[model samples]
Target: MAVAAFPDPDLDPSRWVPLRYLNFFRLVIAGLFLVAGSELQLGHEAPKVLVAVAFAYIAAVLTLGFPDAARRIGLDRLIMLQVVIDIAVLATIMWASGGYRSGIPVLMMVILAGAGLVAQGRAVLFFASLATVVVLAENSWRFFSGRSSADFLQVGFVCIGFFGIAIVARLLALRAKANESLATLRGVALAKQQAVNERIIRDMQDGVLVLGADGRVRQANPSAALLLGVDSLEGRLLAELDESFSDFRVRCASADGALQRMRASGKLLRCRAVGAGEDGEGGGGEGATLVYLTDFEEILQRMQQMKLAALGRLTASMAHEIRNPLSAVMQAAELLTEEKRADVQVRLVRIINDNARRIERMVRDVLALGRREEALPEALILAPFVASLIEESTLGGAAGRDVFRVEIPARATLGIDRAHLHQILDNLVANARRYCSGKPGSVRVFAVDAGGRTALHVLDDGPGIDAAERLRVFEPFFTTHPKGTGLGLYIARELAEANGATLELADNAPGAHFVLTGRTQP
Candidate 1:
């Protein structure tokens, strides 16, 4: 979260830094020319105007340029101008004092080295070549004017020196530019990859906790905070999150990677902790334990659903055998009522009827899953539909209907199949009636308009299913009731989806709650 401290990889050299080096070099070289001229006193025939011009050029470069403001004033061109002026001033001072014998060309060599350090590949060679031209022109004039000058032998040696300096300086400048560019690109790439990694970890639904060596939370995702029922856990001790996790953490420290359960608040969480390996970023678990937290039944429920989906076709194929036999058994049981049956025979017939009904429900659920029906939506006034459903179910002698309560907006509407919607409501109502205690408002129906959709909730006042069991409530053939065929919820969800709606189990502790969300009119 402290991302602001990360350094920017694409570094740019400060304009003042390079400019200070250039200006300081030029000023000092100009001063040396003046001092050397007075000390050597080698000037005899050359005019003093050239020395004055050189001094004026050096003064102009130093006084008029502000290196700190180089960004606004084109710093590269300014540096190039300084190089050109350095060449011209060096030539003027050499001609005015002593053209070939002044030993001032060594100073010119310093400028060449500085150019190689700061300038581009060709720029360094360009500066050195310009100096070569200036030196040749100044010495030629001295030779023609009958001033004390060296022969062709000395001139050839100086030309060779300038050639070698230009070639070597250009190569070094080229290499430096390549290395600097490579470093900058690598930095930018690293920053981008880090950003992507952070985004992925943040968006994950499973709780992620990073703990220090002392078992204090170093970093935690929002899911981790919610799983442990804490507002935040950045600096909290891991033992404080859940006392049940102490043994789990100890086992994890052994590096076995076994899953463990931790009971926190009213929920149970399945967790696994991983310590940093020897080659990991933490270098052998001094810090940074990656703990993954998830509800145990939730993970198991998902795995079961995946298995159910693959077996749905096979179950549907078996539905034909299951359906015909149940119908035959129910028919035979009804026909047997005409006989003079004994009391035990009556009980046996009733048992057959009940079991047949359960088998039929299970087969219907399989059919619904394997052959998914396409949705057919129609707009309907929501408040009136809910009122009618309540009235009809009550008049039909639905047990526990008297305890039902309703809350819905008057102007609500939904676009869905009426029959499919009714089926979903029937399942939820039956579920509520079976579970709600004999108390007022024990079964409540509420609808909320969420702009694009309406959420219809059915709540019951009873000991709610455990958090782990709640995750598998909608799974086929998964139920705690010995007489129940868990397909009621599975079929209900399928029917809801066939009408462009969704069925969901809501996490409402101390009570059971379900929601059926359907799209509303635009």
Candidate 2:
């Protein structure tokens, strides 16, 4: 036959009840009282026998009733009852067993010490005072009855020992309580700190992943799970999850080296996975790898946008430059064709020459769209730069300036490439002048210190762009006019972004409004 073993109760201090220990102590004390009672019954001491019987009965009551009492009235209340019982028992034993001659009066010290384990403050003082009064009364009674001087001295010593024990026990219990309180406060603070750290990690926009030593997924933040297209990643292994993400897992498992690769979505993503041992120390676990994913989608999109924009600008600039030469050629051909005195065969030659020059200019502007360049930048101020650009434009020149107006402030300065700013403003002003022609057309230029940056505005009084064409206006070769290259706004935006600024079309009363905003560095 096999014997069954009972499980031990949990003994964690925070979860422990002092009543359990108290009950155990009560049983031990009952056994002592029973033995003492049996001995007194066997002896011829009548008073001692009666005292022992009473103590035995009291001990039995404590052993049998304490558990139920503790449950009904709480441990703290039961402890107070136990203190009163101890005082009464001690006084009765002292009075019965030869007054002060009975050395048992000192037993109150043990009870006081035990009380310190469970009771405190007023309870401790109450019990201690009770024991003192009982001891003092017994000694006074013994002295009046002519008891021996040695017996009195012995009782006095016992009373002193009782007080000494009670004081020491009370101090020790107070210290223990302080230590426990400090420990609990520390635990609460640590838990709060950990929660904050977890929140920060989960709230990050970039994908973060942690892998176990066996190349299994350990943890993934919300951003990581979203990037990988999963609901949750608690139990899934890294290799078995997604085939598209398998390359990262395989590279991490091989232990060859840290791996970095670019993956494409609508735009490119820079994915980096590295082993845990960059400092040359082995991983704390085994083959764990840390993975980081940064989305470069916006960067690639902006690059494409810039290319189309530069092409537009090049075409527009070339077209404007070629227009002057083509016009002169056209006039010369017309003059030749009108001269009736000239040979009749030469008239066809002049007509062909006029059309050919027009065709050549169109072809040159179209071809200039494919050009690319990487130019260095420099520091430039906006207020003066706008003034210079307006001066250089045909409508802005001193002789032909009556058609347009320019306004600017003197305080706007920024760190930018001077030539790029000039090119952007020139294109904008030229576009406004062309659109507002034949209606007393005017272009207004001004700058304001907007927060930490500068805002430059170019407003024109002309026909405004329709809502449908506004979005596509920056696309390469998409133009409203037959002679326009349609690259001005696109190129201006590209150049502005390259210099860490932005060009945006603002809402205007009649004509187009262009605003360039850039950070001003001291």
- The numbered model that scores best in TM-score is 1
Candidate with top lDDT is 1
lDDT of 1 by residue, 396-479 (tens): 554545678888888777777777677678778877877879676788888898767988889889887898898789776676
Residues 1-522 of candidate 2: C-alpha lDDT, one tens digit per residue: 011122124322321244345445555554555566445332223456544656664554455343444456665666787667766765666565555545555557777887766676777777777787778776786678776323556666776777677778777877877788898899899889889978987998777677775657777789776665567876577656554456665554443323243232232345567666753235424666677655556556887898689657765766675666567666766766676765643765665565566557456545432322443556566666666666677645565566566555566687667766777778888788777753343767777878988888887788888888888877655688765655566667777877788888887657788888887762
* lDDT (CA) per prediction: 0.70, 0.64
TM-scores of all models? 0.50, 0.44
- The runs of at least 3 residues in candidate 2 whose Cα sits more than 4 Å from the true structure, single-residue gaps closed, are 1-16, 36-77, 91-107, 139-161, 185-189, 242-293, 296-522
Worst 10 residues of 1 by lDDT: 1-10
Q: What RMSD, rounded to one decimal, does every model reach?
A: 21.1, 12.8
